[model samples]
Target: MAEVATSASSSANSSARSVSLLVVVDPVARRLDGESVRIAKDVLSAGASHTKVCLPDDPEEFARALGRRGSRRPVVIGDDSALLRAVALLHRRRELAGCALSVVPVGSALGLARSLGLPTGAVAAARAVLDGAERRLDLLVDDSDGVVLGTVGIPPVPAPVPVRAEAGSGPQGAASVRPWLRTCQSLVRTLASSRTARTAVAPGTPGPARLRVEVDGVTLVDLDQPVEGVSVTPGAAGVAVVEVRPLSVGAQASPLTASGRTVTVSGAHFRYRADAVVSGPVGTRTWVAREGAWGLTLPAE
Candidate 1:
């Protein structure tokens, strides 16, 4: 399959004289700290003459920049978050079918990027952007129009609290912070102040909301039970896999799988984490597996 995709991409490239490229850089990527950005800029400039770089801080700006690119292929320069952002933008615009996407991991939260086998450094990643082969990938589109490319969940751990210190505090004061300490701190603060704490319906909670899930018009899991979380993922031969993890203390962990093109999830209002960001408190959401929706460049094994 990889060979076939590569051949097709080569064929497509042969007929095209010039390729327009867009480099969307997320300023916050950890590697983009001053010096790294310079190195990346130099490498990218050397590779493609028509490349245009833009830094978009938020989703709205990212989408707008992509829209302006028209037909050029987009290369995202950031970590998994930036990659996901690019995919979401393309999916929302219905342009995923036409554009090929590439990524350069540049942040601490680059787990997904590594999982996809993307290059961790700037120069190697830039070379991949220029010479890599393209392969079509599945995208999970939620009913609420949100798109994700990774696992989603509502974690059981309580959010962390922010530590307040006086001005002029030295390194000793901040030495205990972990890699995701800021995110943990924010989540803790949110949980404490929120009037209604939204938690997964697990062993300690009230109970799981009764959910009515249908896959390609067929009813699957319909029960009133405590659920830790729900996820919809892509499966073999372009199917939408659905799973529900029940709330239990160390019960066996199993994810439900389904093969279908469309999935509809409807139940009581609840918040859902899509990719890495919390998306909703929606009552009903639907997801469709858009097979071959977009193209990505993965590292050669």
Candidate 2:
């Protein structure tokens, strides 16, 4: 009888103290910085009671690995895109509510992770994964079933062009042109084209999009006014902060701002940048803030 009681107590204690983790190392992250990935893996393996490491070579494999995590705490060692992919997968599976995620920021693009207050250093981030607190965070879900952890930007930002000219184009063995000179040339060309491109119908070159912006069923900006851009960010208490900037006429008009749980934008096709990804030329879209919808592990304050 005493032996049985002792075994029961020992089993209970072991179960209570056990920590199992699933570490997913993104391929891009490994290619970008193998050392950081190694450090993160080492730290997490040593700290966790049991750790299962997975090196996914592609996005499909990455999704499959995370989907099979089972009951283990999922830890991602990758960049902003990888983290977003992981969150998106879980959200799609309807498992976010029950899963708390940890990340060791390892890619060149760490802006989103930094904005979320995640540790950037591999060692620190991994340590936090081992000994950290889970905090519920707000999420923005769009009509198309996309999730945004940070801000949504309208008229998506353009990608940077390569400064160096392609080889074999310049004179044989000629030295490469200076990047600043190329930038100035590009700017001059853009300005010249803009002037020529302006028409009587549209005052500005690359005319502003006519979008209807609504917040919580209240119309803030209509199609009558051309807007330069629109931005939406998830705020506390299940609200989203929205802003619509009108195209500058003779004098710049102050942006229209509102706060609501739902934000809808519709009109001529337009593209938007959500966190790091640029998506769609959709005619309409809506986003709602889900406060405390998901959990993330961060360093304890």
Candidate 3:
């Protein structure tokens, strides 16, 4: 996928005024603070003209807070999943484009949020909510209506169930070493043509399954050909596709790559992990992109 982002020129006065803001602190974040939640609250309270803080206990309450946020900009204080939840709610209500969103990343696996250009620090991110420019960005929405903020992959082995952690548990702080390892992992993923992520299988695990794949309505691989693995990620230009071939008795394995607007995968039941969420065990799935579907608030260039 080509890098998928677009920045609108900032309005001359975007950062000049203190705007009214609805700061919804993710329930998960409230428990994980390690001081991050407090810093976020204090910073946002200080920066906005009128700040209303809502701490929703569950997804329903979270949605209600957003639906009721009249004129105040919403600032999410949680990790990527919390941001994903907010985006999905607003998208379903068809109000996403009309509402620019901000985030104060505060959980494990903050990489996706960071990769989206959000400041990883709670204070910095909260401040950006008040002073940053709004950017329109693309999203990958699957037929199931699930939203993905980052990469999607069909690893050679089954993906692990997503782990949920209490906010500041073992190396859970925003500056913890886990994210550093994740950064190195992401680099390895890139340098290894993504096989480190897409073709990972533990010993004793079953091998990859063959699946038919279609890109932009064009067939990349048909069911007749067996495949070791496949991956689909939303790139700036389009959806990036990769197909890993299993090594033959005498031939080396080769991976195929391509990009398109939509990608379809069908075979026996398969699963994929998209951002922080996982979906499937279904026979087929399709993911399509809506260019510039929503806005993300980020630092002005």
Candidate 4:
């Protein structure tokens, strides 16, 4: 009996220490200081039996690195954008639901990751990748074949896409050094204030936009009424909670709310932010909720 117990214990230890990991570090994560990323690498390496590391700079390289993952579990090291890219790639291949994904959040935009119950600290998130539970989570898929693991809001607040540009172009270009547009706007605001003796517009004040919002084919709001914004959030039981808040202040009626598997919005040209990406200026778009569409490894209990 004692010999049998010892053999079982040894087998369990070996299984625990022999986890194979394909650790793909995003370029953005590498661009940051080495301390956080170094800590994550050291932790994963110490725990896993075999760890293959890849530093992918762009979407193509990122996909290729993941494609060559073989049989090892994939552990992504980056912020929310990096995580979303991995999910998007897997979903495009129709392999997201079947594959368990882990994340080690390591960038400035980690709200989505932390909101999904991932560990915030590097060491904790990395360790969770090894000793965590794989939970099947819900996601929103749009008509355009895009996926959203977080909130989707109309009025088009898009996250920055990861792309490389020349030394003086893209987001860090010389043109971005000063807020020239903002300064001009401030001057205009001051002149308008002097002429009209009124304060500048407060934030959250809506502009005149109208939309027809429908959930499960039921119209919640029509174009007759002006709207400030419309939004959809993941809710219980594979349903998305849809709302259209009246942008106008005087017509303070209750915001229209509905929950359904499908939410559609149509009207004047509009765009929506899905996860980290901003989608179209289309006339209309519909999003469908899929239950257990993907798997995310998070801290146990």
Candidate 5:
């Protein structure tokens, strides 16, 4: 009995130490920092029981390689965008909840990866991937099937343009249009909207916008009040921290803040920055914070 127990313990220890990895090296990371990528690959290969490195040239190939990872743990060797792409892919496939994703941050756009407690250096990140703990983290998913890893900001509002009436129509002409007609018109407008505003609008410049901000079905700010900007970020325990900077008399006022499971923003044509991407002149968007929706491999505490 004693001998059998000792043999079982040894097998358990071996099982704990052994790991199989599928390393996907982002093309952008290769072009920008090939040395770091090489180092990461070497470390991961030496540490893991088995490692298969894939060099996918395009986005489709990247998706395919990740999709066919089989039983090997997928470790992304790239920047935050690459990590996000991997996460988004897994989320879309409904596999994120079951996967423990790892990353070796290797580009200029690594803010999101670093913010999530991933080591910045290639060697450190790779080693952590080999001997790390899997942590379940919160996620903010928008109604459009978009995801935000960190902060989501509604950039400075553009100057509002007045809707004009038809030549023969009166002042209420625009309002007289059927609700469905108005929606159709806005849909067309949204489709035709130029995305240049994503880069053009700076973070804190103030242009007043009449946006209705809601948290969990409760209205925080209605269309009656003009707001300077708004931001939403996932908070602890499946809540979203929201802030609305309302335009004040003569000077900017303190932002109104709230926390909840869902946040909604609606207004005239507007664009928002989610992580590093700018999206939408959307008429309305709602985001829900999903607690512990995905797992990320990080250095063990």
Candidate 6:
């Protein structure tokens, strides 16, 4: 039986040597020094016997690449936006339950990543992906097919539109023409553009849209008053935590909380921000909180 034992040993060695890893880097997340890509490749090389690196131009192409690596874990090298894109794709395909999501944050707008306790630097994030433990987390899915992991809200003002102005304007004009300045101007414009409807507002003044919310088939709030925004946490299952802030107070006041698996919201046309993406202005939509939909690696407690 020496021949049979030798053959089995050879097969085991081949199987051990066949472990492969794929690193999906987002072009937008590429660092100034191009070090994020380098670190990702280096980590994968050191951690696995076989590893491949890929740069996806956008979310669609990223999803396509992910589809090709069936059953192989994906390591995303980007900020929260990129992470959200990956989660959305996995959720859409109903593959989230089986895949372990890894992220290496490499952008300024990484609030969600921070919230999840992911490392800010490329090397630390890479090391986490290589050695971190997986934990199941909740994912929020809205009726418009929007997915959110952290917080989602509808700001009072609409998003800004970029405008180009001639150079050599006055100092004030030049200052106003800057991108951040233009964004502020857009916020002001939105506030000025808000229309007041007698039915939608209280007697004193114009206000936010009044919305009706239902949780798990139970009506939590009827059309009581204008609500500044609604926030939900999908992480808490059987508990649909809802927060309502009024425009007068803005996001200052404490939010309302409820518990359920399904939540339905009805109100005037307002854009929805899921994670970081502005999704829709549908008058009504429902959100279902699915438990244990995906796994993520976080810093050890």
Candidate 5 matches the true fold with a TM-score of 0.79
Clashing pairs in 4: 228-247
By lDDT: ranked, best first: 2, 5, 4, 3, 6, 1
State each model's C-alpha RMSD to the native: 8.2, 9.2, 9.5, 9.1, 15.7, 9.5
Taking the tens digit of each residue's C-alpha lDDT, what string does model 2 give over 26-77? 9878766778888988777666667788888889889888998888899999
Best by TM-score: 2
lDDT (Cα, tens digit) per residue for candidate 1, span 58-98:
66776677787766677777867788878877777787788
Cα displacement (angstroms), candidate 5, residue 250, comes to 2.8
Supply the global lDDT for candidate 6: 0.67
Worst 10 residues of 3 by lDDT: 1-10
> Which residue pairs come into collision in candidate 3?
1-235, 1-240, 2-235, 2-236, 2-237, 3-236, 4-236, 32-167
The lDDT values for all models are: 0.65, 0.82, 0.73, 0.78, 0.81, 0.67
lDDT of 3 by residue, 59-153 (tens): 88888988888998888889888988899999889898798999999976587898899999887888788788999888888898887767776
By how many angstroms RMSD does model 5 differ from the true structure? 15.7
Candidate 1 clashing pairs, residues 3+ apart or interchain: 143-286, 159-188, 208-226
TM-score, per-candidate, Cα-based? 0.72, 0.80, 0.76, 0.79, 0.79, 0.74
Worst lDDT run of 10 residues, candidate 2, spans 1-10
> What's the true lDDT of residue 245 in model 5?
88
Candidate 1, position 203, lDDT:
18
Question: What TM-score does candidate 1 reach?
Answer: 0.72
Q: For each predicted model, how many residue pairs clash, with residues at least 3 apart or on different chains?
A: 3, 0, 8, 1, 0, 2
